[model samples]
Target chain A: MTSELAAGVSGARMIELGRGECLALLAGVPLGRVGFTRQALPVIRPVNHLVDGDTVVIRTHPGSALARHTTVDEVVVYEADDLDARTRTGWSVMVTGRASLVTAPWEAARYRALLIPWTDRDVDEIVSIQADLVTGYRLLR
Target chain B: MTSELAAGVSGARMIELGRGECLALLAGVPLGRVGFTRQALPVIRPVNHLVDGDTVVIRTHPGSALARHTTVDEVVVYEADDLDARTRTGWSVMVTGRASLVTAPWEAARYRALLIPWTDRDVDEIVSIQADLVTGYRLLR
Candidate 1:
Protein backbone atom coordinates (compact mmCIF):
# COMPACT_ATOMS: atom_id res chain seq x y z
CA MET A 1 0.00 0.00 0.00
CA THR A 2 1.07 3.59 -0.62
CA SER A 3 2.12 5.73 2.35
CA GLU A 4 -1.07 7.75 2.03
CA LEU A 5 -3.22 4.61 2.11
CA ALA A 6 -1.35 3.33 5.12
CA ALA A 7 -1.81 6.62 6.95
CA GLY A 8 -5.53 6.59 6.17
CA VAL A 9 -5.86 3.07 7.57
CA SER A 10 -3.94 4.07 10.68
CA GLY A 11 -6.11 7.13 11.17
CA ALA A 12 -9.23 4.95 11.04
CA ARG A 13 -7.72 2.58 13.58
CA MET A 14 -6.83 5.47 15.88
CA ILE A 15 -10.41 6.75 15.84
CA GLU A 16 -11.63 3.30 16.80
CA LEU A 17 -9.44 3.24 19.94
CA GLY A 18 -11.36 6.32 21.09
CA ARG A 19 -10.81 6.05 24.87
CA GLY A 20 -10.40 2.48 26.09
CA GLU A 21 -7.38 1.64 23.97
CA CYS A 22 -5.78 4.92 24.92
CA LEU A 23 -6.20 4.01 28.57
CA ALA A 24 -4.55 0.68 27.89
CA LEU A 25 -1.58 2.36 26.21
CA LEU A 26 -1.25 4.84 29.07
CA ALA A 27 -1.32 1.94 31.52
CA GLY A 28 1.45 0.11 29.67
CA VAL A 29 3.79 3.10 29.91
CA PRO A 30 5.39 3.79 33.30
CA LEU A 31 6.14 7.49 32.69
CA GLY A 32 3.64 10.23 31.81
CA ARG A 33 2.79 13.85 32.55
CA VAL A 34 -0.30 15.00 34.39
CA GLY A 35 -1.68 18.40 33.33
CA PHE A 36 -3.83 20.10 35.95
CA THR A 37 -4.74 23.56 37.20
CA ARG A 38 -3.01 25.30 40.13
CA GLN A 39 -4.89 28.40 41.16
CA ALA A 40 -6.34 28.80 37.63
CA LEU A 41 -2.97 28.39 35.85
CA PRO A 42 -1.89 25.20 34.08
CA VAL A 43 0.61 22.94 35.85
CA ILE A 44 2.14 19.91 34.16
CA ARG A 45 4.37 17.41 35.91
CA PRO A 46 5.94 14.04 35.22
CA VAL A 47 4.38 11.17 37.13
CA ASN A 48 5.07 7.51 37.62
CA HIS A 49 1.86 5.55 37.12
CA LEU A 50 0.14 2.17 37.03
CA VAL A 51 -3.06 1.02 35.39
CA ASP A 52 -5.41 -0.54 37.91
CA GLY A 53 -8.34 -1.85 35.89
CA ASP A 54 -9.84 1.29 34.28
CA THR A 55 -8.15 3.87 36.50
CA VAL A 56 -4.68 5.47 36.30
CA VAL A 57 -2.92 5.43 39.68
CA ILE A 58 -0.20 7.90 40.79
CA ARG A 59 1.47 8.35 44.16
CA THR A 60 2.35 11.64 45.88
CA HIS A 61 2.65 13.20 49.28
CA PRO A 62 -0.20 14.86 51.14
CA GLY A 63 1.56 18.24 50.89
CA SER A 64 2.18 17.94 47.18
CA ALA A 65 0.37 20.21 44.72
CA LEU A 66 -0.49 17.10 42.70
CA ALA A 67 -2.29 15.74 45.73
CA ARG A 68 -4.12 19.00 46.35
CA HIS A 69 -5.36 19.39 42.78
CA THR A 70 -6.49 15.79 42.57
CA THR A 71 -9.23 15.95 45.11
CA VAL A 72 -12.05 13.46 44.59
CA ASP A 73 -13.76 14.26 41.28
CA GLU A 74 -11.73 16.91 39.53
CA VAL A 75 -11.08 16.71 35.79
CA VAL A 76 -7.50 16.47 34.50
CA VAL A 77 -5.49 15.51 31.46
CA TYR A 78 -2.82 12.78 31.36
CA GLU A 79 -0.46 11.87 28.53
CA ALA A 80 1.96 8.98 27.83
CA ASP A 81 4.18 8.20 24.87
CA ASP A 82 6.22 5.32 23.40
CA LEU A 83 8.57 6.32 20.60
CA ASP A 84 11.55 4.94 18.62
CA ALA A 85 13.83 7.38 16.84
CA ARG A 86 15.45 4.76 14.63
CA THR A 87 12.39 4.05 12.53
CA ARG A 88 10.59 7.19 13.64
CA THR A 89 7.76 4.92 14.77
CA GLY A 90 5.83 5.41 17.99
CA TRP A 91 2.49 6.25 19.62
CA SER A 92 1.16 8.69 22.20
CA VAL A 93 -1.99 8.26 24.23
CA MET A 94 -3.85 10.99 26.11
CA VAL A 95 -6.49 10.53 28.77
CA THR A 96 -8.85 13.22 30.01
CA GLY A 97 -10.25 11.84 33.24
CA ARG A 98 -11.74 12.61 36.62
CA ALA A 99 -9.07 12.42 39.32
CA SER A 100 -9.74 11.14 42.83
CA LEU A 101 -7.55 10.72 45.87
CA VAL A 102 -7.48 7.06 46.83
CA THR A 103 -8.00 7.09 50.57
CA ALA A 104 -9.10 3.53 50.96
CA PRO A 105 -6.39 1.64 52.81
CA TRP A 106 -6.48 -1.51 50.73
CA GLU A 107 -6.52 0.29 47.40
CA ALA A 108 -3.71 2.56 48.48
CA ALA A 109 -1.63 -0.37 49.69
CA ARG A 110 -2.08 -2.20 46.39
CA TYR A 111 -1.00 0.84 44.44
CA ARG A 112 1.95 1.39 46.75
CA ALA A 113 3.13 -2.11 45.93
CA LEU A 114 2.99 -1.59 42.16
CA LEU A 115 3.80 2.03 41.25
CA ILE A 116 7.31 2.97 42.36
CA PRO A 117 8.82 6.37 41.58
CA TRP A 118 12.40 6.66 40.37
CA THR A 119 13.13 8.91 43.31
CA ASP A 120 13.25 8.70 47.08
CA ARG A 121 10.41 11.19 47.34
CA ASP A 122 7.68 11.01 49.98
CA VAL A 123 4.41 9.48 48.88
CA ASP A 124 1.59 10.12 51.31
CA GLU A 125 -1.27 10.51 48.87
CA ILE A 126 -2.39 8.11 46.20
CA VAL A 127 -4.22 9.69 43.25
CA SER A 128 -6.19 7.78 40.65
CA ILE A 129 -7.99 8.98 37.57
CA GLN A 130 -11.10 7.26 36.28
CA ALA A 131 -10.81 8.19 32.63
CA ASP A 132 -13.76 9.84 30.93
CA LEU A 133 -12.17 10.19 27.52
CA VAL A 134 -9.18 8.26 26.20
CA THR A 135 -7.62 8.79 22.78
CA GLY A 136 -4.45 7.53 21.05
CA TYR A 137 -2.57 7.41 17.74
CA ARG A 138 0.21 5.32 16.24
CA LEU A 139 2.82 6.72 13.82
CA LEU A 140 4.08 4.27 11.26
CA ARG A 141 7.38 4.63 9.47
CA MET B 1 7.23 27.03 59.97
CA THR B 2 4.68 24.25 59.81
CA SER B 3 4.52 21.97 56.78
CA GLU B 4 0.99 23.18 56.06
CA LEU B 5 2.01 26.83 55.86
CA ALA B 6 5.05 26.02 53.74
CA ALA B 7 2.94 24.00 51.40
CA GLY B 8 0.43 26.81 51.05
CA VAL B 9 3.10 29.38 50.25
CA SER B 10 4.86 27.03 47.88
CA GLY B 11 1.62 26.34 46.04
CA ALA B 12 1.10 30.05 45.48
CA ARG B 13 4.65 30.49 44.21
CA MET B 14 4.25 27.56 41.87
CA ILE B 15 1.09 29.05 40.43
CA GLU B 16 2.89 32.27 39.67
CA LEU B 17 5.65 30.42 37.85
CA GLY B 18 3.08 28.48 35.86
CA ARG B 19 1.69 31.66 34.41
CA GLY B 20 4.81 33.25 32.86
CA GLU B 21 8.12 32.21 34.45
CA CYS B 22 8.46 29.20 32.13
CA LEU B 23 10.19 31.21 29.43
CA ALA B 24 13.48 31.36 31.31
CA LEU B 25 13.24 27.75 32.46
CA LEU B 26 12.75 26.63 28.87
CA ALA B 27 15.97 28.36 27.87
CA GLY B 28 18.00 26.64 30.57
CA VAL B 29 17.05 23.04 29.86
CA PRO B 30 19.08 21.16 27.24
CA LEU B 31 16.75 18.24 26.64
CA GLY B 32 12.99 18.06 26.13
CA ARG B 33 10.13 16.23 24.43
CA VAL B 34 8.61 17.35 21.17
CA GLY B 35 4.96 16.41 20.79
CA PHE B 36 3.38 16.16 17.35
CA THR B 37 0.52 14.45 15.55
CA ARG B 38 1.24 11.65 13.11
CA GLN B 39 -1.69 10.16 11.28
CA ALA B 40 -3.89 12.22 13.61
CA LEU B 41 -2.41 10.54 16.69
CA PRO B 42 -0.27 12.45 19.20
CA VAL B 43 3.38 11.29 19.44
CA ILE B 44 6.21 12.54 21.64
CA ARG B 45 9.95 11.90 21.60
CA PRO B 46 12.99 13.11 23.48
CA VAL B 47 15.28 15.59 21.72
CA ASN B 48 18.10 17.97 22.51
CA HIS B 49 17.00 21.60 22.23
CA LEU B 50 18.54 25.07 22.13
CA VAL B 51 16.96 28.38 23.07
CA ASP B 52 17.30 30.89 20.22
CA GLY B 53 15.84 34.06 21.64
CA ASP B 54 12.09 33.31 22.04
CA THR B 55 12.12 30.11 20.04
CA VAL B 56 13.09 26.48 20.76
CA VAL B 57 15.32 24.85 18.12
CA ILE B 58 15.71 21.10 17.42
CA ARG B 59 17.02 19.12 14.48
CA THR B 60 15.86 15.92 12.80
CA HIS B 61 16.45 13.95 9.62
CA PRO B 62 14.94 15.17 6.35
CA GLY B 63 12.33 12.37 6.16
CA SER B 64 11.60 12.08 9.89
CA ALA B 65 8.02 12.07 11.20
CA LEU B 66 8.86 15.17 13.23
CA ALA B 67 9.99 16.92 10.10
CA ARG B 68 6.77 15.99 8.31
CA HIS B 69 4.50 17.08 11.17
CA THR B 70 6.40 20.33 11.74
CA THR B 71 5.55 22.09 8.54
CA VAL B 72 5.64 25.84 8.23
CA ASP B 73 3.19 27.52 10.65
CA GLU B 74 2.31 24.22 12.36
CA VAL B 75 1.56 24.50 16.05
CA VAL B 76 3.43 22.03 18.27
CA VAL B 77 4.09 21.60 21.97
CA TYR B 78 7.63 21.44 23.40
CA GLU B 79 8.23 20.35 27.00
CA ALA B 80 11.31 20.33 29.23
CA ASP B 81 11.73 19.25 32.86
CA ASP B 82 14.42 19.34 35.53
CA LEU B 83 13.81 17.05 38.50
CA ASP B 84 15.68 16.57 41.77
CA ALA B 85 14.70 13.34 43.44
CA ARG B 86 16.57 14.00 46.71
CA THR B 87 14.35 16.85 47.86
CA ARG B 88 11.39 15.86 45.73
CA THR B 89 11.82 19.21 44.05
CA GLY B 90 11.41 19.60 40.30
CA TRP B 91 10.05 21.89 37.60
CA SER B 92 8.51 21.42 34.15
CA VAL B 93 8.04 23.95 31.36
CA MET B 94 5.99 23.59 28.21
CA VAL B 95 5.87 25.74 25.07
CA THR B 96 3.00 25.68 22.63
CA GLY B 97 4.41 27.36 19.55
CA ARG B 98 4.44 27.58 15.78
CA ALA B 99 7.10 25.36 14.15
CA SER B 100 9.00 25.89 10.92
CA LEU B 101 11.92 24.14 9.26
CA VAL B 102 15.05 26.24 9.53
CA THR B 103 16.70 26.85 6.16
CA ALA B 104 18.92 29.80 6.80
CA PRO B 105 22.46 28.47 6.21
CA TRP B 106 24.21 30.49 8.93
CA GLU B 107 21.38 29.99 11.45
CA ALA B 108 21.40 26.23 10.89
CA ALA B 109 25.18 26.16 11.38
CA ARG B 110 24.87 28.07 14.61
CA TYR B 111 22.29 25.58 15.91
CA ARG B 112 24.51 22.68 14.86
CA ALA B 113 27.28 24.08 17.05
CA LEU B 114 25.06 24.37 20.14
CA LEU B 115 22.55 21.47 20.12
CA ILE B 116 23.95 17.99 19.69
CA PRO B 117 22.00 14.85 20.61
CA TRP B 118 23.85 12.36 22.81
CA THR B 119 23.06 9.54 20.44
CA ASP B 120 24.36 8.60 17.01
CA ARG B 121 21.07 9.63 15.48
CA ASP B 122 20.79 11.13 12.00
CA VAL B 123 19.76 14.80 11.95
CA ASP B 124 19.14 16.65 8.71
CA GLU B 125 16.01 18.69 9.31
CA ILE B 126 16.34 21.69 11.62
CA VAL B 127 13.04 22.77 13.20
CA SER B 128 12.29 25.78 15.38
CA ILE B 129 9.19 26.77 17.34
CA GLN B 130 8.28 30.38 18.11
CA ALA B 131 6.62 30.05 21.50
CA ASP B 132 3.05 31.34 21.63
CA LEU B 133 2.02 30.16 25.12
CA VAL B 134 4.45 29.14 27.84
CA THR B 135 3.50 27.62 31.21
CA GLY B 136 5.28 25.71 33.98
CA TYR B 137 5.58 25.01 37.75
CA ARG B 138 8.12 23.94 40.33
CA LEU B 139 7.36 21.38 43.04
CA LEU B 140 8.65 22.16 46.53
CA ARG B 141 9.71 19.62 49.08
Candidate 2:
Protein backbone atom coordinates (compact mmCIF):
# COMPACT_ATOMS: atom_id res chain seq x y z
CA MET A 1 0.00 0.00 0.00
CA THR A 2 1.57 3.29 -1.10
CA SER A 3 0.87 6.11 1.32
CA GLU A 4 -0.42 9.47 0.10
CA LEU A 5 2.44 11.19 1.93
CA ALA A 6 5.15 9.20 0.18
CA ALA A 7 3.39 9.77 -3.10
CA GLY A 8 3.15 13.47 -2.37
CA VAL A 9 6.78 13.76 -1.34
CA SER A 10 7.89 12.18 -4.61
CA GLY A 11 5.44 14.39 -6.44
CA ALA A 12 4.39 11.28 -8.36
CA ARG A 13 2.36 8.32 -7.20
CA MET A 14 2.23 5.02 -9.03
CA ILE A 15 -1.08 3.23 -9.12
CA GLU A 16 -1.84 -0.06 -10.82
CA LEU A 17 -4.90 -0.51 -13.03
CA GLY A 18 -7.07 -3.58 -13.27
CA ARG A 19 -7.53 -5.54 -16.50
CA GLY A 20 -10.90 -3.99 -17.34
CA GLU A 21 -9.70 -0.50 -16.57
CA CYS A 22 -6.69 -1.04 -18.78
CA LEU A 23 -8.87 -1.96 -21.73
CA ALA A 24 -11.03 1.12 -21.21
CA LEU A 25 -7.97 3.34 -21.18
CA LEU A 26 -6.67 1.70 -24.31
CA ALA A 27 -9.99 2.19 -26.07
CA GLY A 28 -9.93 5.86 -25.22
CA VAL A 29 -6.66 6.60 -27.04
CA PRO A 30 -6.33 6.71 -30.83
CA LEU A 31 -2.57 6.63 -31.22
CA GLY A 32 -0.25 3.90 -29.88
CA ARG A 33 3.13 2.37 -30.53
CA VAL A 34 3.32 -1.27 -31.61
CA GLY A 35 6.42 -3.19 -30.56
CA PHE A 36 7.80 -6.37 -32.09
CA THR A 37 11.11 -8.03 -32.81
CA ARG A 38 12.83 -8.00 -36.20
CA GLN A 39 16.10 -9.90 -36.60
CA ALA A 40 15.97 -10.44 -32.83
CA LEU A 41 16.11 -6.67 -32.35
CA PRO A 42 13.01 -4.97 -31.00
CA VAL A 43 11.23 -2.50 -33.29
CA ILE A 44 8.33 -0.17 -32.62
CA ARG A 45 6.06 1.88 -34.89
CA PRO A 46 3.50 4.53 -34.04
CA VAL A 47 0.04 3.97 -35.51
CA ASN A 48 -3.62 4.65 -34.82
CA HIS A 49 -5.81 1.82 -33.56
CA LEU A 50 -9.40 0.89 -32.73
CA VAL A 51 -10.57 -1.32 -29.93
CA ASP A 52 -13.30 -3.75 -30.98
CA GLY A 53 -14.52 -6.08 -28.28
CA ASP A 54 -11.35 -7.46 -26.67
CA THR A 55 -9.22 -7.30 -29.80
CA VAL A 56 -7.46 -4.28 -31.31
CA VAL A 57 -7.43 -3.68 -35.04
CA ILE A 58 -5.26 -1.41 -37.17
CA ARG A 59 -5.05 -0.70 -40.91
CA THR A 60 -1.83 -0.64 -42.88
CA HIS A 61 -0.56 -0.98 -46.41
CA PRO A 62 -0.30 -4.58 -47.55
CA GLY A 63 3.15 -3.88 -48.90
CA SER A 64 4.22 -1.65 -46.05
CA ALA A 65 6.95 -2.63 -43.60
CA LEU A 66 4.44 -3.20 -40.79
CA ALA A 67 2.84 -6.10 -42.63
CA ARG A 68 6.23 -7.70 -42.99
CA HIS A 69 6.96 -7.31 -39.29
CA THR A 70 3.71 -8.73 -37.83
CA THR A 71 1.99 -10.93 -40.38
CA VAL A 72 1.41 -14.45 -39.11
CA ASP A 73 1.73 -15.26 -35.39
CA GLU A 74 4.21 -12.65 -34.29
CA VAL A 75 3.80 -11.43 -30.73
CA VAL A 76 3.40 -7.67 -30.45
CA VAL A 77 2.77 -5.06 -27.80
CA TYR A 78 0.47 -2.09 -28.29
CA GLU A 79 0.73 0.81 -25.89
CA ALA A 80 -1.06 4.13 -25.44
CA ASP A 81 -0.62 6.91 -22.91
CA ASP A 82 -2.05 10.29 -21.95
CA LEU A 83 0.59 11.80 -19.69
CA ASP A 84 0.90 15.46 -18.75
CA ALA A 85 4.42 16.67 -18.00
CA ARG A 86 3.41 19.72 -16.02
CA THR A 87 1.08 17.91 -13.65
CA ARG A 88 3.13 14.68 -13.69
CA THR A 89 -0.12 12.79 -14.02
CA GLY A 90 -1.70 10.51 -16.59
CA TRP A 91 -2.23 6.85 -17.51
CA SER A 92 -0.51 4.33 -19.78
CA VAL A 93 -1.88 1.02 -20.98
CA MET A 94 -0.21 -1.81 -22.88
CA VAL A 95 -1.66 -4.94 -24.47
CA THR A 96 0.45 -7.92 -25.43
CA GLY A 97 -0.81 -10.36 -28.06
CA ARG A 98 -0.29 -12.24 -31.26
CA ALA A 99 -0.95 -10.40 -34.54
CA SER A 100 -2.64 -11.86 -37.59
CA LEU A 101 -4.27 -10.54 -40.74
CA VAL A 102 -8.02 -10.18 -41.11
CA THR A 103 -8.47 -12.18 -44.30
CA ALA A 104 -12.19 -12.85 -44.12
CA PRO A 105 -13.82 -10.44 -46.58
CA TRP A 106 -16.86 -9.75 -44.40
CA GLU A 107 -14.85 -9.27 -41.23
CA ALA A 108 -12.42 -7.04 -43.09
CA ALA A 109 -15.19 -4.75 -44.21
CA ARG A 110 -16.64 -4.58 -40.70
CA TYR A 111 -13.29 -3.78 -39.13
CA ARG A 112 -12.52 -1.22 -41.78
CA ALA A 113 -15.51 0.71 -40.51
CA LEU A 114 -13.97 1.21 -37.09
CA LEU A 115 -10.31 1.47 -38.09
CA ILE A 116 -9.71 3.92 -40.91
CA PRO A 117 -6.40 4.65 -42.52
CA TRP A 118 -5.29 7.98 -41.10
CA THR A 119 -2.86 8.58 -43.97
CA ASP A 120 -3.47 8.20 -47.69
CA ARG A 121 -2.08 4.70 -48.06
CA ASP A 122 -3.70 1.69 -49.67
CA VAL A 123 -4.04 0.30 -46.13
CA ASP A 124 -5.49 -2.84 -47.64
CA GLU A 125 -4.54 -5.06 -44.71
CA ILE A 126 -6.20 -5.21 -41.29
CA VAL A 127 -4.09 -6.61 -38.46
CA SER A 128 -5.99 -7.79 -35.40
CA ILE A 129 -4.34 -8.65 -32.13
CA GLN A 130 -5.61 -11.51 -29.94
CA ALA A 131 -4.52 -9.95 -26.70
CA ASP A 132 -2.93 -12.29 -24.17
CA LEU A 133 -2.24 -9.83 -21.37
CA VAL A 134 -3.31 -6.27 -20.62
CA THR A 135 -1.81 -4.03 -17.95
CA GLY A 136 -1.68 -0.35 -17.06
CA TYR A 137 -0.43 2.25 -14.57
CA ARG A 138 -1.46 5.72 -13.58
CA LEU A 139 1.06 8.34 -12.47
CA LEU A 140 -0.39 10.84 -10.02
CA ARG A 141 1.09 13.98 -8.58
CA MET B 1 10.43 7.10 -54.82
CA THR B 2 6.78 7.96 -54.17
CA SER B 3 5.01 9.99 -56.81
CA GLU B 4 3.26 13.24 -55.98
CA LEU B 5 0.02 12.00 -57.55
CA ALA B 6 -0.30 9.02 -55.25
CA ALA B 7 0.35 11.22 -52.22
CA GLY B 8 -2.26 13.71 -53.43
CA VAL B 9 -4.85 11.03 -54.03
CA SER B 10 -4.37 9.37 -50.64
CA GLY B 11 -3.47 12.65 -48.90
CA ALA B 12 -0.96 10.56 -46.94
CA ARG B 13 2.43 10.39 -48.59
CA MET B 14 5.38 8.56 -47.04
CA ILE B 15 8.82 10.12 -47.19
CA GLU B 16 12.02 8.70 -45.72
CA LEU B 17 14.16 10.87 -43.46
CA GLY B 18 17.92 11.23 -43.65
CA ARG B 19 20.05 10.09 -40.71
CA GLY B 20 20.83 13.58 -39.40
CA GLU B 21 17.27 14.67 -40.04
CA CYS B 22 15.87 11.82 -37.98
CA LEU B 23 18.12 12.67 -35.04
CA ALA B 24 17.00 16.27 -35.22
CA LEU B 25 13.38 15.20 -35.08
CA LEU B 26 14.16 12.96 -32.09
CA ALA B 27 15.78 15.85 -30.25
CA GLY B 28 12.68 17.93 -30.83
CA VAL B 29 10.41 15.47 -29.05
CA PRO B 30 10.28 15.47 -25.22
CA LEU B 31 9.31 11.83 -24.79
CA GLY B 32 9.38 8.45 -26.56
CA ARG B 33 8.41 4.82 -25.96
CA VAL B 34 10.98 2.15 -25.15
CA GLY B 35 10.36 -1.44 -26.35
CA PHE B 36 12.01 -4.63 -25.14
CA THR B 37 11.28 -8.25 -24.42
CA ARG B 38 10.27 -9.54 -20.98
CA GLN B 39 10.00 -13.32 -20.61
CA ALA B 40 9.92 -13.51 -24.43
CA LEU B 41 6.99 -11.09 -24.45
CA PRO B 42 7.48 -7.66 -25.90
CA VAL B 43 6.69 -4.68 -23.65
CA ILE B 44 6.88 -0.91 -23.95
CA ARG B 45 6.85 2.13 -21.69
CA PRO B 46 6.87 5.83 -22.47
CA VAL B 47 9.84 7.79 -21.11
CA ASN B 48 11.61 11.12 -21.30
CA HIS B 49 15.05 10.90 -22.94
CA LEU B 50 18.25 12.77 -23.67
CA VAL B 51 20.19 12.22 -26.88
CA ASP B 52 23.82 12.42 -25.93
CA GLY B 53 26.52 12.77 -28.57
CA ASP B 54 25.20 9.52 -30.08
CA THR B 55 23.43 7.42 -27.48
CA VAL B 56 20.01 7.85 -25.84
CA VAL B 57 19.88 7.93 -22.02
CA ILE B 58 16.72 7.48 -19.95
CA ARG B 59 16.07 7.56 -16.21
CA THR B 60 14.06 4.88 -14.44
CA HIS B 61 13.50 3.53 -10.95
CA PRO B 62 15.96 0.95 -9.74
CA GLY B 63 13.17 -1.39 -8.74
CA SER B 64 10.88 -0.56 -11.61
CA ALA B 65 9.96 -3.49 -13.85
CA LEU B 66 11.83 -1.86 -16.74
CA ALA B 67 15.13 -2.09 -14.92
CA ARG B 68 14.71 -5.83 -14.65
CA HIS B 69 13.83 -6.25 -18.34
CA THR B 70 16.59 -4.10 -19.90
CA THR B 71 19.72 -4.50 -17.81
CA VAL B 72 20.91 -7.73 -19.37
CA ASP B 73 22.24 -6.62 -22.77
CA GLU B 74 18.79 -7.06 -24.26
CA VAL B 75 18.12 -5.31 -27.54
CA VAL B 76 15.52 -2.55 -27.31
CA VAL B 77 13.73 -0.06 -29.51
CA TYR B 78 13.03 3.58 -28.74
CA GLU B 79 10.38 5.39 -30.77
CA ALA B 80 8.68 8.79 -30.93
CA ASP B 81 6.23 10.40 -33.34
CA ASP B 82 4.03 13.42 -34.02
CA LEU B 83 1.01 12.98 -36.29
CA ASP B 84 -2.06 15.08 -36.80
CA ALA B 85 -5.12 12.93 -37.41
CA ARG B 86 -6.97 15.79 -39.04
CA THR B 87 -4.22 16.29 -41.61
CA ARG B 88 -2.91 12.71 -41.52
CA THR B 89 0.56 14.15 -41.59
CA GLY B 90 3.46 13.85 -39.15
CA TRP B 91 6.85 12.20 -38.57
CA SER B 92 7.83 8.99 -36.77
CA VAL B 93 11.32 7.96 -35.69
CA MET B 94 12.70 4.70 -34.23
CA VAL B 95 16.06 3.69 -32.77
CA THR B 96 17.13 0.09 -32.15
CA GLY B 97 19.98 -1.14 -29.93
CA ARG B 98 21.02 -2.67 -26.59
CA ALA B 99 20.16 -1.15 -23.19
CA SER B 100 22.52 -1.11 -20.21
CA LEU B 101 23.09 0.96 -17.12
CA VAL B 102 25.27 4.07 -17.11
CA THR B 103 27.79 2.71 -14.58
CA ALA B 104 30.21 5.57 -14.56
CA PRO B 105 29.25 7.94 -11.77
CA TRP B 106 30.29 11.02 -13.73
CA GLU B 107 28.39 9.85 -16.83
CA ALA B 108 25.27 9.23 -14.76
CA ALA B 109 25.51 12.69 -13.23
CA ARG B 110 26.08 14.24 -16.62
CA TYR B 111 23.04 12.45 -18.03
CA ARG B 112 20.96 13.39 -14.98
CA ALA B 113 21.57 17.01 -15.91
CA LEU B 114 19.88 16.45 -19.27
CA LEU B 115 17.09 13.95 -18.53
CA ILE B 116 14.76 14.66 -15.60
CA PRO B 117 12.04 12.39 -14.32
CA TRP B 118 8.57 13.79 -14.93
CA THR B 119 7.09 11.89 -12.00
CA ASP B 120 8.35 11.37 -8.46
CA ARG B 121 10.29 8.13 -8.50
CA ASP B 122 13.77 7.22 -7.25
CA VAL B 123 14.82 7.17 -10.92
CA ASP B 124 18.39 6.44 -9.91
CA GLU B 125 19.03 4.06 -12.77
CA ILE B 126 20.38 5.44 -16.04
CA VAL B 127 19.68 3.12 -18.96
CA SER B 128 21.47 3.93 -22.18
CA ILE B 129 20.81 2.45 -25.61
CA GLN B 130 23.61 2.28 -28.15
CA ALA B 131 21.56 2.75 -31.30
CA ASP B 132 22.40 0.25 -34.01
CA LEU B 133 19.77 1.53 -36.43
CA VAL B 134 17.93 4.81 -36.70
CA THR B 135 15.10 5.15 -39.18
CA GLY B 136 12.25 7.56 -39.71
CA TYR B 137 9.45 8.43 -42.13
CA ARG B 138 7.21 11.43 -42.67
CA LEU B 139 3.61 11.27 -43.80
CA LEU B 140 2.58 14.22 -45.96
CA ARG B 141 -0.96 14.86 -47.03
For this target, which candidate reaches the highest DockQ against the unseen true structure?
2
Clashing pairs in 2: A120-B12
Clashing pairs in 1: A19-A134
Worst-scoring 10-residue span by lDDT in model 1 chain A:
A7-16
User: Tens-digit lDDT track for model 2 on B1-141?
Assistant: 132233343447789998788888888888889988878888899998878756788988897666876667777889988887667789998988888888898888777766667666678789998767899999985
The two-chain DockQ for each candidate, comma-separated, is 0.08, 0.45
Across A1-141, the per-residue lDDT of candidate 2 in tens digits comes to 132243343446779999899888888878888888777777888888988888888877886555776665888899999887557689999999988888898898777666656666577688888768898899975
- Model 1 ranges with Cα > 4 A deviation: A1-31, A34-45, A51-56, A59-141, B1-13, B18-20
Would you estimate the TM-scores of all the predictions? 0.55, 0.87
Q: What is candidate 2's CAPRI-style docking category based on DockQ? A: acceptable
- lDDT for each residue of candidate 1 in B1-45, tens digit (9 for 90 to 100): 123333332221233375346877877766677766555434455
